[model samples]
Target: MDQSLKSPGQSALEDAFHAMFELTRTKPAPTLAERLDRLARLRALIANNESRFEKVISADFGHRCATETAIAETLLVLGEIKHAAKHLKKWMTPQRVPTALQFLPAKNRLIPQPLGVVGIIAPWNYPLQLTLAPAVGAIAAGNRVMIKPSELVPRFSALLKEVISTKFDATEIVVTGIEDDISQAFASLPFDHLIFTGSTRVGRLVAEAAGRNLTPITLELGGKSPAIVDRSADLGEAAERIAYAKLVNAGQTCIAPDYALVPEASVQDFAEKVQASMRRMFGTDPANKDYTSIVSDRHYQRLESLVTDAAAKGARIVQAAKPDDPAWKTKRKFPPTIVIGVTPDMTIMQEEIFGPLLPILGYKDATEPVSYINRHGRPLALYWFGKDNATRDEVLARTVSGGVTVNDCLFHFTQINQPMGGIGASGTGAYHGEWGFNNLSKLKPVFYRSPFNRLADLYPPYGAKISRLEKMLRFMS
Candidate 1:
């Protein structure tokens, strides 16, 4: 149906689409100044609502730390906005290219233009950052944006909607709440581009829906990312970093270290250090206020099931908290856990464990881990810990992952200059920094024909002259 003739009672999805379409028709390409203005507004909105955003997101999670919110969500987006604002003018400028000798009087240039409407669908984990960071890129490219945040985090979702609504015009940016069937319609809309960040299962469905509209999409899906501990590594420091990365947000992160490949002889030592690190970070059983709880009861049960299935399959389950600790009884808090002797038949190894569960797989050599990683789908991130440059180089060259962090974990995602994304099953396409601006924009090529051109010499009357010109052109370079 023609959007212009849609019914009065059309779904809210239609309203958002029509609003952005009408607005784009009025202002096809925003000026650089206009783009900067939008980014500035986004930064200010987060700056002004830092405390409230922390409070609401904590309410969404059982209890998220205000500092974590500030660092992961608020500060991250703020830094992105600043980076974009500083370089957007350069990104938007037309780039010149060399014209071929055959077209001596012609000039070539590439123009970057917005792709009308960009739709961003974010997940429950890192709700604020996932939703807004992409918006920062789309806005930098001067596209009208519509964001759909996960409904599971209702408090953050509602607050995000409220914040965007209060600070932005409906035609410029719209935030939609999770309204069941209406969301299906949102994905199927003929958007210029779409970005979905979540599970690989849902990513397939979203891709299928967008395919019907011939809409280009960017998928930021999750996978079982791994951390490799080499023979020469500082085992204690590796355990500390890995534990912090896994336990943050209760391991409800897309790039969290899902498992580790430790040297066979040092597996027990590494595991012990990881337990001590967990104790120091969250006290006994993670009862401290700093540790975040599972986002929902359903997820809590799912994590429990992963642990139970693994244990039933002969995996040795080590509890960081005291046995039968009351912390696990809570509807939200799932204590830190580490699994050993895990096999491929177990459920934990088969899927991306999006909770506080870590599996330590023993490896005899560096190539063993590389071969193991290659056997499965590509991970979103990979971590290597060791001072042996030769071993690190071999691991780096032998394995393929979306991104890598050397001697540490999860911090590779902090570099705004580097593009952050997944590969193959983990995800498709990339974004962040200049990569994002280019992803959302269409880099169109324009050629100028000089009036004094001699192309008429080889026109339709082509015979000997045309043959000579073609042959000469082939060898001209």
Candidate 2:
């Protein structure tokens, strides 16, 4: 936490607050074309700074793959910008509604209005994408934005501050790099809408702070997202996809499959296949330059502790490869770890294992696995690997989550049309594509009446006319 950075962040936030207020209150609402142009500019800004963003992320995380940054952050942000640009006009247009027969000469419409200043608190996992994605929606909705990138990724945070400061003014868009206290102060600011993406614990604190101002929030929190493997599923493909998804970014993804529920008869077989796939992906040594390392030493220690605690409690630990060199340990490079026979009482099962440790639980039947999933708080994402459409439909219909994928993992979120959000504890509110625009805009209903159809009879004091109006209402109903 640099004092110099903190000071500028505070000043930037205040300037952003005033700027947003002025833009929302005084500036004429931007037309659909204007909104699209703004999004286009954002796209160019991100594309132009892609290399710098990747470099900053790599410096922050120690070994972030540039390709991963492109796919997860840069490309994703660009895609969001393009999606918003394509749909802005239609999303912004006022929708006409049917007027009641009693108000024959009246017309009704639903108009969307921007919610002024929107604050986005993004986590370090996907720093650039998370910050820019929501900001795209806010801008597309004709609102100003202030972004607070996680201090954990200091290099990326600094890079974002530089890029944003150079590209846009504080009134239109701004980014902050600050310490914990400064972060808290930024969260406490009264914004029209706020979006925070992080762990559920921190999300609760953010929600509490935002509640003070009655600010609407879109919380994108992570939980123990599960992957269920049915007896009839293609074990080879499932193992490959699941392994790729879990090991990507060293399993730091919010929507990555945290654990698997495999059939008792196929547990051993699935484990073998998963181990083989892991070897193919990362080879015998995951410490090689090809593999991504844990974000920091603190997170590495946390994962090690979880593994140690689980092992002491009689959980079987299996690693994809053995670490033969001292360099691996010092670099915080953890091999893809799989734990078995884990009980609900274990620490790994109790908390979100946001690392490379994947747990496998054996169930006697599909019903048992489904019951187990339902017993837990709804997750942000659910992955089911099966071929039967009926079985998939049954699970889909019964299971509750923010998003779901059939015969795959973590890909549902890539679709721009489908809404992504969670039920119960995972999170609240959906944002992406049209959903994003809707989240930042207020839909106000308006009714217009013609002088010819001004029903004065119904406006008078209660009398025989009221009875006649009631009769007419009944008829219309």
What C-alpha lDDT values do all the predictions have? 0.88, 0.85
Q: Please give the range of 10 consecutive residues that has the lowest summed lDDT in model 2.
A: 320-329
- Predicted candidate 1 versus true structure: per-residue lDDT over 379-401, tens digit per residue: 99999999999999998898888
How far is 68's C-alpha from truth in model 1 (Å)? 1.1
Residue pairs clashing in model 1 are none
Q: What's every prediction's RMSD, in angstroms? A: 2.2, 2.6
Off by over 4 Å in 1: 1-10, 322-324
Give one digit per residue, the lDDT tens place, for model 2 in 1-477.
354666665766676687778778888888887787778778888888889888888878888877888898888889889888877888899998988888987799999999888999999988888888888889988888888889889988887888777777777888866676669888788899999999999999999999998999999998999999988899989988898889888899999999999988887888888988988887766456667778888898888889888899999889855433456666767878888889998899988988888899999977987899889889999999988888888898998899998899988998988887876678899888999989999988998878888478778687988898889889989
> How far off is residue 373 in model 2, in Å?
1.1
TM-score of each: 0.95, 0.95
The TM-score measured for candidate 1 stands at: 0.95
Candidate 2 lDDT score relative to the true structure: 0.85
User: Per-residue lDDT for 107 in model 1?
Assistant: 96
